[model samples]
Target: MRRFFAYLTAFIREDFNLRLYAGTAAFVAAMTAFNYAVDLEDGIIDKHRGEVLRFWLYAGLDAFMYYSVTVFWLLANRQLSILKTARFWLFSLAAIGVLAWWQDYTGYSKVVGLPVFGEIYSFAHYCFSNLSSALTVWVPFAVFYLLVDRQPSHFYGFRPDWLSLKMYGILLLLMVPLIAWASFQPSFLQTYPIYKGWGAARALHWPEWIPAVIFELCYGFDFISTELIFRGFLIIGMMQVVGRGAVLPMVAVYATVHFGKPLGETIGSVFGGYILGVLAYQSRTIWGGIAVHLGVAWLMELGAFLQSFVHSPEK
Candidate 1:
């Protein structure tokens, strides 16, 4: 715990520009407010869901603006030479924009058509959607690491020794009460236990827990891709160009990704993303962030399940 705090403190000491931090915070807050105030993501962007080209364009622009504006702020304040690293800045923003679109893309359903899979389409789609992040985020980044960055180190924070799960476990423990508290909120329950069972368990004549567990596992695995992109790629990969300045921009955009989620969750992502960003910057590994993320997500699932079970009419 002390070690984690030390990492955060050290990063702050090195890169704590009051104007940069304050301006970035104001930007994130304003965007978050605008998004939720009019229900921009769920109401507007998602309304175009399944319209592949349109959805991609909207989401991509949204993500790119958040990231680029934050980076612009950093460059303005720090007077960083953007001309020298223009290629990297463009590539990073474009990749992140495409990633944002891909994360929510519903066009995958067409590929898993019900005509082919019959009653299993729901289950198949659910699992595929959850697990596809590995391919979507990891493959491109891996190729970029090999062909472009060519860093002779572990590919963007995959170094095992740089992570301390014990410390992350402690962080998870601290979050238990918070997750439990969130489970009782009407909004939280509505979105959690993210496994809907989708009637697939009944259709397949299988126990409900089977599909639930499968969905949970696939759901948890998606966070690895998230950590890879946000912490590993954004912080560690971009460190060469932006140094410690990467963390705040990453935090700003990270919060935007959660805009479609509950307001509290979106707000929480800012703090969580920052701490993980700092840790990734200091340790040069993403394993600890993965651990805490997976733990909190699964715990939220467990909390929601227990809450629902206790309130179920069957009970």
Candidate 2:
């Protein structure tokens, strides 16, 4: 815990520019407010879900605007230099665009339509959709790392270190009460546990827990991809270009990506993304972030599950 605070304090002391931080915060707050007010993500971007190019374009532009604007602010303030690294920025934005597109992409619906999968299509589709994030997000970034980054260290924070795990666990423990409180909210319940089973259990004559457990595993895996992208790729990978200035831009865009989620969660992401970005920057490892993320995510699932079970009419 002390170590975590030390890292955060050091980063802030060295990197905290009042104007830049305030400007970025204001930008993020306004963007978040407008997004929720207009239901931008659900009403606007997601409306093009199945239209591959259109969805990609909308999601990509949304992410690009948030990220680019923050970076632009950094540039305007003389905090970042894009002189020779134009290609890196372009590639990074393109990769973020691809990830945004892939995240909500509905192209997999075609596969779910096949008759071979039978009544279990819902279960299969749910699992496949979540699991595919690993491929979509990681593959492009991996290629980028090999071709461009080729950093001498481990692959964007995948290196193992058992020492930090305890700190991460304590962080997760601290989040327990907050997550439990969220579970009782009308909005949180509406979105959480993420797997409705889509009637897969009834159709297949299988226990609901089977599909739920499988879905939870896949859902948890998506967080690994998330940590890799936001904490690992965006913060660590971009640090080479922007130095410690990478954290806020990543936080702004990270919050943007959460627009479709419950409002509180979206708001929480700004803080969460910032903390994880700073920690990742300091430790040069994403494993701790991964642990805390997966732990909090799964805890939310559990809380939602327990809430549902307790409130079920059958009970």
Candidate 3:
């Protein structure tokens, strides 16, 4: 317990800027509330199949929100000149747009012959889709290290945590029952295993193992991206800018990202983000956050699968 408190104390002791943190949090909160309102409006409308103009519009808006919040704090710190930041944003957005578009292009245009559902093409698409978002966020960071920043990636705090495995294991074990019990909740069950849409899993024309394998890989990738962005990039990358204050706004944005997920999860994410952020700040690594995230995520997947396997009716 003494060790745990000490670890937390170090996390809080960093050279924090409270004003910057508060301003960033307010920006995220307002934007998130706006997004939620838009989402509610979108939910009420019925659209034709394959008509995703609304979806694209919302995605673009969300991207803009992310960019706004990101640049606000970076500007507050005055680390980079205006021209450099402009250049960074231009490259970063373009890369992400290309990756997002490439998913559709590769799935539709490049696959030999017409892409059929539940076939090899679909499986390839699913697997790559998992990795695409991770790569989109990762590329700029990598480029920054190699070309611009020139510091080791560890400067962004990707090293092994001082309390990595031990802390993660303890949290994982503690979360076991709460996560399992939530799995049985109607709201939770509905949103969980959000990877259900691949449909290839049930298309018996394909080998049974193919969809499962792709799904598991995608599942792992989703959490990896989540950790890298929220815990690694947001907290550590911004640490020099806002110091320990970075963690708060990161927590705000992190929790808001889960706004469309289950209510329990959205609420849980706020607490979980804080805990993981503290660990990342103290240990100088997001590895522990990744471990905790993956463990809890996989456990929820297993729990949801088991309930369905046992034919438990939704509560």
Candidate 4:
């Protein structure tokens, strides 16, 4: 295990340079081509059916290909110390391959719109989307490594306790006010949609518990992936360079990701991302942010549920 880690480290440091970034760029390009390819075949039924196949192909296959190419390129560059140890590289590749496949199959990256390349101001759009969607994770990682990791010397006054449930409690407390404010707003109930299963409840109102659970369970996959990609991987990776200040980039990326959102909501999301980015940096764990993330998703789902209750004709 020690030797394997050594090789992995070497590979990452030496071979895993801008090539990985290039591979990711390729993934973006393929996704765009596939989408446009599908769109062009709108008239023919057989061609239209290819869209679904292409969606999975470009989405799933491309992710694996990207990861594989990066790893292989790292090995070829002799960046991996113990390329002699086939077990290590194989295991690492297998794990990431599985994760990439699962994420693609679930359509996690679908919302990350095509990067507008040179076409019609596409380059700017592409840059913004990439920066917003994936680059955010690199920032927090940089900050944690620079500021937090190097500060182990001041252990006694570090205030590690603040990184506990107290922080989580504070988050919950803050959420209460936002929830209250949203609930009281007349327009709050109409802003989001809640899907109700086709049942007797369609004809009349029913307890929202079931639909809330259903929606949360279903949509939660994509939500968690977004958090993992943006908050977990990107920020964590970037922390290697920028140290603690990486949160700034994370927030910027987070805000940009929501550019398609309404101004007020987009601004609010940036604030939320900033808060989550801090927690991630402080705790050195994405799980903390994931918990907060799940909470926010639940709140959104709850808000949707309340909307149903408020808007029902029976009400």
Candidate 5:
């Protein structure tokens, strides 16, 4: 117990040099205000025009929020020179804008070899969108790191620490009771297991496990992209430029993405993002964060599934 508190407090001393705690708070406030100004939804792609509109609207806003946070991060760190920053922003935002707009298509899947994907259309779409989204940051990051920033290796935040993973596992274990409690809440159950809208199995009439597997794969890939952007690119990539301040800004931006979640979760994400940022910076690995993220998500999904099964067997 004493050691745990020591590790917890020492995290601030060791990994929380970010003078940008206020900045993170400010960003979250501004984002909360913006969300109040609009109706945000998780993207749901469909041939119907209404769903397409929702996808572009939410995705465009999310892209703006995320990349704008990135710009603020680079500015605060001043990691790159004026010209380089300008160039980076121009191309990076352009890529995100173009790809997001492209995703608004009714025929996008067919154009991108969905016919070949056949039964795994959901998986293919998942791969295409997620990989494209990952590339939006990764490509420019690669060029900037290699050519401009001059990193020795492009490892990003992919470092692994098996011994330290125990620490993260413990953290997840500690959350089980809280998550279980939340599972009993109607609001929590309704909001969580967020992939129900995808409806891959019902739409395709395939085995339920097919969609479950695809969704999990998609969740895993998406989390990897997220870790790279926040923990890897923003935290580690900008560490030299901004010191520990990098983590806080990433935390702020991460919490912003959780805007549409329940109030408790959106608020919890602020701290969650901060902790993951610290873990990535200290261990120089996003694996622990990934494990915690996937574990928490699947656990939430399972909890929700169990509750629904017990109460509403028709579901």
Candidate 6:
């Protein structure tokens, strides 16, 4: 047991730069506080109260925990630059659009708002949904560029363009089963069918070409934003101090960011983020990961757009 504890302690220290005793204590304290806030009284009168409290507790816990981890990783690695340059922001937006489209197509539009809201609320929600999803990519991208700013000179310069091509071929071959499984996972939440209103109710449902074009544009923003935040900022930032070992924190944080996702996508993201981080780190260029990321993302978005069109009774 002593040896086991030692091993566990060493693992956190090595993987997350976490000092075992203090980190363990901190985690326990946080969890205890979270649980206390979410506890329910065993009576009917408090049922709704309990549920609302639980919801808020979980939400707060998630946000706080994520922030804590990022802070911990940054401090351990000693990243001085918290904000990145303009070039990074530009690239990040491009990446977010591509990625967001891909996830949408893969039926990962779980982030979407419910279709039932009063006109003003719905209009505001729709505007925010598109706008927020479109712009939120900067968060992670800024983090990544800062983290990688101090990387050693020899970290980059590997070129296997042919290898990348071959790997993509393999991915294409495998994507058939992968996509099928991803698309059909059951959701308890029922999604609204495509509504064809213009502007306010502007149904994103119209000629496939028209909506597709608009979606593609929106998606470009969405995908790049996401990538910039996760792949570019969060992952890259952690890598500075963690070195190649940074993949540990990178995957953990990436998966958590998708905590809003369904189980399958969340699970998929853990593995996917790991692979993308490794590829990005190895190539010393985000290009390889970008290509793969963009390719998969676009395919997913296109699929979702088409499915909504085909399945919409109104259309």
The whole-model C-alpha lDDT of candidate 1 against the native structure comes to 0.79
Error of 5 at 187 (Å): 2.2
lDDT of 6 by residue, 1-315 (tens): 233234335544455443633453365345434334544112221343323453343334344444454445456556524425454334333333333332332122233434443333443344344446433434433343456344453222223355544554455556756544544433311332222333443443345465435444554555555554455544454445345444544555465445444456656776677666655554444444555665676655545555656667997
What C-alpha lDDT values do all the predictions have? 0.79, 0.80, 0.62, 0.46, 0.64, 0.46
Specify the highest-lDDT model's number: 2
| Model 3 Cα shift for residue 123 (angstroms) | 5.1
Better of 3 and 4 by lDDT: 3
Least well predicted 10-residue stretch by lDDT in candidate 3: 100-109
How are the candidates ranked when ordered by TM-score, highest leading?
1, 2, 3, 5, 6, 4
What ordering of candidates by lDDT runs from best to worst?
A: 2, 1, 5, 3, 4, 6
Which residue pairs of candidate 3 clash? none
Candidate 3 local Cα displacement, residue 202, angstroms: 6.5
lDDT at 281 for candidate 1? 90
The alpha-carbon deviation from the true structure for residue 192 of candidate 2, after best TM-score superposition, in angstroms, is 3.2
- TM-score per prediction, in order, is 0.90, 0.89, 0.69, 0.46, 0.68, 0.50
For candidate 1, lDDT tens digit of each residue in 251-279? 87788778888798899899889999998
TM-score pick, better of 3 and 4: 3
Between prediction 1 and prediction 5, the one with superior TM-score is: 1
lDDT of 4 at 175: 83
Worst 10 residues of 5 by lDDT: 39-48
Model 1 stretches astray by more than 4 angstroms: 52-73
lDDT of 5 by residue, 106-220 (tens): 3444545646666556555755665554545556666766676666654677666786678788888988998899899988876776556355576678888777776667666
Cα lDDT for residue 14, model 1?
79
- Please give, for residues 195-245, the per-residue lDDT of candidate 3 as tens digits: 554556565556666677667777787677777777776667655445654
lDDT of 4 by residue, 241-307 (tens): 3344344434544543343344566567655775566555545556556556667667765776666
